[model samples]
Target: MNAIIVTGGDIDLSLLESYISKNKYTIVISVDAAVKKLEETGKLPNVMVGDFDTLADEKRLEYYAGLGIEIVRHNPVKDFSDTELAIDWAYKRNITEIVIFGALGRRFDHTFANILMLRKYKKLGVDITVVDRCNRIYVKSNPFILEKRLVWGKYISFFAVKEKVFIESLTGVAYPVENKYLDNIENPSLFISNEIVDDYMSVIFDGEILVVESRD
Candidate 1:
């Protein structure tokens, strides 16, 4: 089954509703302020995890608890992030895939950390993707196909997370490459702003690469 972990970050309400309606997410876990966001949508999460620092309203807490939503409250001084705790809860249930919402926000550190979490969990054989208003990010180290139909946005960009990444073959995109090594971080647009020309794009690469699909 697939799980969705909602973080307390910037979220587009319409987009969140779209995902909630269309996607058959078996486990819905909200972290901290995201619980309120989910509540605003008139839907309840299966489980809520957080320290309740930001959401300190007593009545609201009782309201969700009254609805039988399992609330996993933690200490404010805990080491792990609220979102990380939510991921752990969902992953422990033998979930096959995890999609994170509200990961991108005003805070760059939180957003970047959420992106890295994708790579960390993907190594554990869990298919994880971080989705927001304009981007869908995940780390890929194997050959994969990025079809236009399933692509998150019109443009796809690749950011190397490792020291060096060697792309073996790339096709079906506007700027196709073969046997190219992306090792430098100097140029930010080295493998960015690419679009699928035809029906799909194929990428075969070595080392960790953060594949970013954006509306631009």
Candidate 2:
């Protein structure tokens, strides 16, 4: 089972609802502004977290409270983002995989910050994915395999989150790489827009790389 977090980002309601209906999500967390959208999904969150500063439907929270949904409100001046706090809540309960929607919205700072969480939670032994209408982003360090059928979209990209990333081989894709070291600052676009040509794509890498599966 996986957990899903809905943040205050631009999301497709139909897509979100379809995902919820098709998957087994033990926990559903709606951040402040996302509460309104969550309600439209016809599903109640297991818990709601955030300060009400950006809430769209403030009154609906009370309705959720009346239905026994746990409200984990935090102070507006807190350090961590509401999404991060919600992630912590799930992690404490032993949920290792988390999928977040609405994270890649208009706010570049928030979107970048959410991407960084992929690295942070990875260190804490949790896999976090930030997904939206066109992209699914995550961080990977170890050698991994991506089966074509399981890939999120038509295009796949890799980025070096750190200063440098050494990829021994990137195979089973349209552009295969061998013994290549990519510099984050210099060659960030070198690994973007590759397509899986075989049944599976495999990557052997030495450092952390941000993996993006996107559709145009």
Candidate 3:
């Protein structure tokens, strides 16, 4: 099944609205502060998951309860992070493709952790994406076709999240590379910005490839 997952990182409501309006998904799950974002946007999530630590006020918790939102609260001392818990919950329900919003532009550690978390779900054979106002980030395990869309982005970046990823073919990009190996680098700016030129692009790789479609 298809689902949209919103994490508690900084979010852009206008961007979120555009995505939701275009996609007809089965469910929407919010994590932590994303619940409040949904409230502000007049969009109710199907499920809300998080430990209430990010929320400062107790009244906010009560406010959610008053709205009859079913919140799955985890212990503050749990081993898995709240975002992990939310992903686990969705995976248990057999949700395959997940589009995540409000997942970037916050604490660097948290953002980095969540990006790595997306890789953990790769073995499950599910398509997961972490999105924000400027980018749609995802991990690619094998060869795939990417369609070009006029989103709020101009540059595309592909990094080998694992050791190395072999690119089979590329099109619709300014600096297109084919049959190349993207090695894990200390400085990732080498693969930071790329552009797409055609209607679609193809990427083939063996290990994990983290693709960031960004703007500016």
* Candidate that scores best on lDDT: 2
lDDT of 2 by residue, 9-75 (tens): 8899998999889889889998887877987988778889898788745677788889999999889
Candidate 1: tens digits of C-alpha lDDT, residues 1-216: 898888888988788878989989898999987887887887789998999899888788888889898999999998888888888787788886998888889988888788878877788778888888899888887889977998888899997877678889889999999998876566556898989997989999988888889995
Report the candidate with higher TM-score, 1 versus 3.
1
CA lDDT scores, all candidates in order: 0.86, 0.89, 0.80
Query: Which of 1 and 3 is ahead in lDDT?
Result: 1
Off by over 4 Å in 2: 56-59
lDDT agreement of model 2 with the native: 0.89
- In model 1, what lDDT does residue 147 have? 74
Per-residue C-alpha lDDT of model 3 across residues 47-116, encoded as one tens digit per residue: 8888878765678777777878778888889888788888899899998898888768658887898888
Task: Please say which candidate is ahead in TM-score: 2 or 3.
Answer: 2
TM-score of each: 0.95, 0.95, 0.88
Clashes of each: 0, 0, 6
- Point out where model 3 deviates above 4 Å: 56-68, 150-152
